[model samples]
Every structure is written in C-alpha cells, then in structure tokens.
Target: MQLVALVPAHDEQDRIVATLAGLYRQTRRPDRVVVLADNCTDATAEIAERCGAEVFVPVANRDKKAGALNQALEPLLTELADDALVLVQDADTVLAPDFVRTAAVALDDPEVGAVGGVFYGEQGGGPLGLLQRMEYQRYAHEIHRRGNEAVVLTGTGTLFRASVLREVRAARRAGLLGGGTGCYSLASLTEDDEITKAVKTLGHRTVSPDGCRLVTEVMTSVPALWHQRMRWQRGALENLRDYGRTPVTAYYFRQQFLLGLGTLALACFVLFAVLNLSVNGWQGAAPFWTAITLIFVVERAVTVRGAGPRAVLLAALLVPELLYDMFRQAVYVKSLIDLALRRQEHWYAT
Candidate 1:
C-alpha cells in the first residue's frame, strides 16, 4: 500500500531538521513527504526542501493547521489513489525507525481507520525541562497502559486512511463537522478530535499501537504549558458543540464533569478555610486539607512510575501541583468563555 507522510510546520526551523531526519530513518519510508509551511516567517520551507520533502507554502489564514492540512491534501489526493494512507505528524515529534511500518500494518485491517503511536518525552534540557519530561512520561505511561481503551485525542504522531479522511472532508463540506457555518473555520481548534469522532461515527476504529513509538518535545516553562493547555481546553470545548446529543458525546461531558468536580472541591475547601478562620482559629482545618492533598499526591506518584523517586516526591509536596491544578481550572474556564464568544483560536508553537 502507498503511504504519504504529512508534516504541518510553521516557524519550526529549529526542530524541523531533526523531525525530517527521524522520518528518513523510518523502516518503511513513505512514497512522499509533504510539508505544509503555514505562514512561516522563517526558512521552514527552504529547510524542508533541503531535507528532500515536497514543501507547500499556504496562504496565511485563521484556521492554522487545519487550513494548511486541507490545502496540502488537495494536491496529494490528485496524485495518489483514494486508498492510500496518510500519516500526519507534528514538526516537533520524532518517530521510531519502524513507526510507519507498524502503523501501515495496523491500518491494513479493514476495521481500523486510524492508528496512533506511543509518545514519550525527550530529556536533557534542564530542571524545568526535566519536570515537563516527567509529566509527559507519566501521561504516556497512563495512555499506554490504557491501550486502545483511551480516546485518540491528538494528531501529533497519527496515521489516517485516505478513505476515512475523504469521509471527514465530505462531512466538513456538508457542514457536519466543526462549530461554524463554513467548511473550515478558525473557531475550531481540535481538528484531530473532530476527525476521530467522525471516523468512529462512520463505524471505523481508531487505535494506539503497542509497538509504534514517537518522541515529542514538551513545554519547558510553566507559562508555556499553561498556554498550551488553555488552547487544548478551549478547542475541546468548541468541538463539544459539534458532537451535540450523540452517545459519543459522553467523552466530552466526562472531561467537563471531572473539571467541574475539581472546581467544586477547591471552592468547598476555600469556604471551609474561611469559616474556620472566622469561627475557630488559623490552625483549623489545615491538617485535614493537608492530608487530603497528600492522598492526591500519593496517587499521582503511584500512577507515574517513570517520574523517579525525586520527581514523585516533588509531586507529593503538593505546593506546585496544587497551583498547577488551579491554573488548569482557570484556563478551562477561560477557554470555555472563549468558545462561547466564538473567538478565533490563534495557534501558537508549543
């Protein structure tokens, strides 16, 4: 079966070379590699061309990745057959030598429409970088353990059948995907989630393979992580509106419910502290909350074995983790508001 690797890049000169080098290392090389350089002020296109990829520079637009991907696919579809597999990869991710081969074999099954590989964090930057690495490693471990039970959330290292993509494109043309009236809109951010749901709606399965793997860089700073999470939360909220009332909508609702519970728990704890300060003393309820917080820390520590003892201990300290949770909740609330306002999502390099 013929395969194409599509890499969406924008101002990624620093990371593009390594990504291409990894692609070159793939055991089963794709028939073609297409790089969508979207509004890049840098030499991303030139660099991609130097790396031997067919580069396409798209017109600047609000839809960002989705727009660039749609434009890139137009020419690819004309050149390739409808049954070809298209592997969508981010510019920051590096695949294993056998990643493409594994994905191709997995998708050979008629029932599997899409497949994603395991994502791990690369190390050797600094303390903040190490923290981010540990966080991602923990997340990857959970996702890996969950296997195919976990929802296919992102497109960082994912492969899709061209037939499935055509169905998604047809739905987009009919205004059945995304939130806005147009076929493609800047208001929708999590296009991967939307497409995965669409594939499932068409009775195709999406899975994460056990052998396929990819390494990705994570945000090194807290502020960067916050912004990235904010965009994801906002995009997820926007995608929820499109799914509407379907049984598959439970995934979105489950995330919202968990966030709501977290928010309510924090609020109740604050109220209890305030009441205690007014009635009894400063020491009141502190120990109880501390114990409760320790429980969460312990759970996280047990859940993330790759974090090492030191990182797990740090997580147990609860000073920064609690603050992180608070920040996440705030981001979630703001993203919901942004979605409600129908504001355009500005894609930023994470």
Candidate 2:
C-alpha cells in the first residue's frame, strides 16, 4: 500500500533537515513526504525541499501544529487515493530505519485504525535534560509493555489510515468533536487528544508497536520543560471537558480517572505535610516527609535505570522534577477552568 508522511513545522530550520533525513532512511520509504511550513520566517521550506519533500506554506494564521496539519491534509487527500496511509511526525523527532515498516505491518490488521510507536529522548543537555530523557525512556517501556492495549495521548510519531482521517474530518465538520468548534485547530493545545478520542469513538482500534521507535530531543532547561508539560497537561484537561458526559468509555475514562487521582494524591500529600508542620512543628513531620521523599527518589531511580547510568545520575540531580510535574498539573486544572469559562487561549511557542 502507498503511504505519505506529513510533517508540520514552524521555524524548524535547524532540526527539519535531520528529521527529513531520518524519514528518507525509513526501511519502507513513504510514497511522498509533505512538509507544512507554518508561519516560518526561517528556511524550513527550503530545507524540506532540498531533502526531497513537497512543501506547503499557509498564509492564513498558523494557529499551531494542528492548523498546519489540517491545511496540508486537503491537498494531500486530493492528490492521493482515499485508501492510502498518512503518517504524522514532528520536525524535532528522528525515526528508526524500520519505524515506518513496523507501523505499516501493524496497520495491515484491518481492525487497527491508527498506530503510535515508542519514542526516546536524546540526552546530553544537562542534568534536567537527563531527567527528561529518563522520563521518555520509562514512557516507552510502559507503552511497549502495554502493547496494543495502550492508551495513546500524544501525536508526535503516529500513523493513521486515510479512512480514519476522513472519518475524523467528517466528525469535525458535523460539529461532533471539540464542542462544535468546526474542526479543531492546532491552535487549541489539545487537538491531538481530541483527535485520538474521536478516532476511538468511531469503533476503530489504536495500537502502539513495540518495535517501532523514534528519538526525540527534550527541553534542556527547567523553564522550558515547565512550559512543555504545562501545555500538555492543560490540553488534556481541555479535551476531557470537550467530551462532556459521554458515557465513560472504558479506555478514555480510565485514562482521565488516573490523571485525576494522581493529581488528588499529590495535593493531599502537600496539604497533610503543611498541616502537620503547622500543628506540631517541623520536628514531628520531618521523619515522615524525609521517608516520602526517599520513596520518590527510589521510584525515580528505578524508572531511570531503563535509560542507563547517565540518566540515573540526572534523575538524582533533578529530584524536584516530580514537584515540577505537579505544578504542571495545577496549571492544567486552571487551564481547564479557563476553557470552561470560555476564556481565550493565546498561542505560544514550544
């Protein structure tokens, strides 16, 4: 079957060439590669073209990745047959040589509508960078272990059958997705989550192949990491709201419930620690807090072990990453409230 790779990029000149090169190296090369150069002041289009990709630059507001993707979709669908496969990837990610081949083989199963693969973070920026690397490694391992039953929430390196895309597009047009927004834009930070849910709602299966992998570069600084996670958490909450009262489907409901429980657990821990300190002084709660912290450190170490020694060391140095993640969840809660209240969501860089 013929396949097309769609890459949405914005000011990614430095990284686009490497990503395209990786695509070229795929064991099962895509029939065509389309790069959506959204609002780029740089030479992203030039680089993509040089690397043998068909490039499109949208003049309209490049709201975000989703917008660029939708803009590219119409042209691609018009040019290719309806039965073709379309793979979406990020400009900063590099796929393994066999990644596409593996995804294609998995999609060969008629029941599977979409497939996501393992993604690893490249290391060596700093201590925080190492923590990010370890986090990605743990994520890859968990998804691999879960196999096709995994619930995928991100859209970094995923493949979709053209039929699924058409269904999603139709749902968007009928105002069944994203609270009647008429085809969600990439501008809405959580468009990926929305799309994934939409596809699942149509009774098609989404799978993650253990053998397919992609290497990604993580944010090196604490502030950058904070922004990245905040966007993700906030988007997730927003999408959950958009689904409003749909009888909790097992897969989707379980994912949301776990996130909510995790948030509640963290909040309870902080509140208990504060109240104990206020009533009995630091001495009384000191031991308990230390023990809890040690437990967290050990858990982090175990997770980082999958990435090797350097990652473990980085996890040790960045022990506060969990707190940072908690902060992101708090931001997500706030963002969800804002979205519910109809507050505007301004676009920002990643």
Q: Against the true structure, what is each candidate's TM-score? A: 0.86, 0.86
Overall local distance difference test of candidate 1: 0.76
Task: Give model 1's TM-score versus the native structure.
Answer: 0.86
Clashing pairs in 2: 66-186, 67-186
The lDDT leader among the candidates is 1
lDDT of 2 by residue, 225-299 (tens): 666766776666666665765643555667767877888888897899799888988674467867987787777
- List the lowest-lDDT window of 10 residues for candidate 1: 178-187
Count backbone clashes in candidate 1: 0
What is the lDDT for 343 in model 2?
A: 74
Model 1, stretches more than 4 Å misplaced?
60-62, 124-131, 178-187, 274-296, 340-345
Query: Which residue ranges in model 2 land beyond 4 Å of their true spot?
Result: 178-187, 247-250, 274-298, 314-318
How far out, in Å, is residue 218 in model 2?
Answer: 1.5
Tens digits of lDDT, candidate 1, 1-350: 78899999989999999999999999999888988899899999999999899998877655688788877776676676667988899998999999889888888789988887777777655555556666666766766777653365356788888877777667767776654432134356677767667777767888877667888887778778777887778767767776775777786688788987988799788799789789877764568877987788788777656756766776766676566567778887788777778777676667
lDDT of 2 at 189: 72
